[model samples]
Target chain A: MSWLHIFFALILLPAVAVGMIRILKGPTAADRMMTAQLFGTCGVAILLLLGAGMANPVLIDIALVFALLSALSTLTFVRRTWQPGKKKHDDPLS
Target chain B: MTILYHSGTFFIGIGLLFFLSGTVGLIRFPDIYTRLHALTKADNIGLGFVVCGLSLQSGNWAVIVKLLLIWLLVLIASSASCHLIASSGMEKKIKPWTRP
Candidate 1:
């Protein structure tokens, strides 16, 4: 069972790394933001798996909090990028 | 009892395979929107399978309930976040891949 937990952790690490690459190399700001959200989701899954494997119940709470924070961060990023009172035609329409 | 354990392992293996495919799709996809779709749908389902496997292993009512709740929360958040991000990208004119 512990080995299975380790397997999950191993898989999750590479997933996070790939997401980080997108965050770092994304062509646009929105792309990076989306990658960050993906990373957050992966983190929650990994945390929960670890908690179960290690027999520590407290980590479940941590995973829940991380999930909430990730959602809030995504909302904040969207709100920041799409601010109101800005002219839609600031640049010539593509 | 042995059958139950073997079934649990089989589900866990399948879940891992799906997760690996999701990762590969994320890397191979040409555009951010496509990658989001792969991860949000495929990976979310893969994680759901894993949670189910874990619940079976736990064999306790309280822990299984907690696992189910966690999976539900993750599913909802993953889809919502993907939608929010993709729509925001469209608004910004982030432009998808040109290749068909």
Candidate 2:
């Protein structure tokens, strides 16, 4: 019974692989970072599924932490990449 | 009942299909914005079905509450992250992909 969910967990691997490829070939830096975000969400889903399948509640807690941290990663990305006040006349990198 | 178990499995199967399509769209979509749309929308719904399926299997209040929390948290995070990514792209002035 639980093994079936584990099989489902295994099925999730290819999505992560695809996300990795996007990280590699994504045209823009934001694209790469967004792909990583996708990985984080998928990782959460996989963790939840596996925790239930294996009867290990700890994986669920880890998924909770993973979700919180993934959001942090996005915040870091936006902070580093976006410059709201710097207009066209100003240095774009700043 | 075996029928309930089968129904739960069926729900999970549907969820898996949605997840597959979402990931496929994440890669195949023409641009980053659209790709984000694909992933966030489809994957969120997919995870919903999966949680529903799992809840049916467990029949426990605490576990079900935890599953709901996980879903809600991811829901909030994905949308927030999506906004951040969109704003960053706009900040950098990345052009959207215009359909031919």
Candidate 3:
């Protein structure tokens, strides 16, 4: 059982690294947002696996909340990015 | 005697292969859209398999239910988020790659 937990953790770590790369190197804001969502999902999975491995029930609730928040954040970002708007230039002299 | 252990190991191996392929796809894909496609599809399936293997080991009905719920939530969230991101990227006119 412990070995399975370790195996899962090992599998998840590479995903985390790949997600970080996308977040860092993504060509567009939307791309970065997608990468962030990936990280959020992976994070929740890791927490759930850890909880199950350690027999800690409370972590499941925490993971659930994290999943909900991640979904909400992605939705908000998508809405903002998709809305029609003129590009805002931040120039004090304008 | 050893058949059950072998079966569990086979399931775990398949799950690990999925995860590895997903990571490789993420690293090697040319564009954000393609990468998202790979990650959303492969990771969710990989995690699903892993959860199934873990639940088999657990042998607890309550914990199995919880695992299933978590897997469902993950799949839903990942697919929805990926769709939203890809559409938003298209709306923003992010240049898609073209092989010459």
Best by lDDT: 2
| Span of 10 residues, lowest total lDDT, candidate 1 chain B | B1-10
Residues B1-95, candidate 2: write the lDDT tens digits: 67766787787778878888888887888888898898888888888888888778777899889988988988988887787677567766888
Winner by DockQ between candidate 2 and candidate 1:
2
- Ranking of all predicted structures according to TM-score, beginning with the best and ending with the worst: 2, 1, 3
Model 1, range A1-94, lDDT digits (tens) per residue? 4767767767777877876676667767766776777677677778877887787878778887887788778767766654444444443221
lDDT of 2 by residue, A1-94 (tens): 3898899989888877877777888888777887777777788878988987898989989988998888888776776555434334452322
> What TM-scores do the predictions have?
0.84, 0.89, 0.80
As for candidate 3, its clashing pairs are none
lDDT by residue for model 1 over B6-97, one digit each (tens)? 67767766776777677677777888889888788877877788778767777778878877787788777778777777766787678877
User: Which candidate leads the pack in TM-score?
Assistant: 2
Error in Å for residue A35 of model 2: 1.7
Clashing pairs in 2: none
Query: What TM-score does each model's chain B reach against the true chain B?
Result: 0.93, 0.94, 0.89
Per-residue lDDT of model 3, residues A25-67, tens digit only? 7666766776677667677767766766677778778887888
Docking class of 2: acceptable
Q: After superposition, how far is residue B21 of candidate 3 from its true place, in Å?
A: 2.5
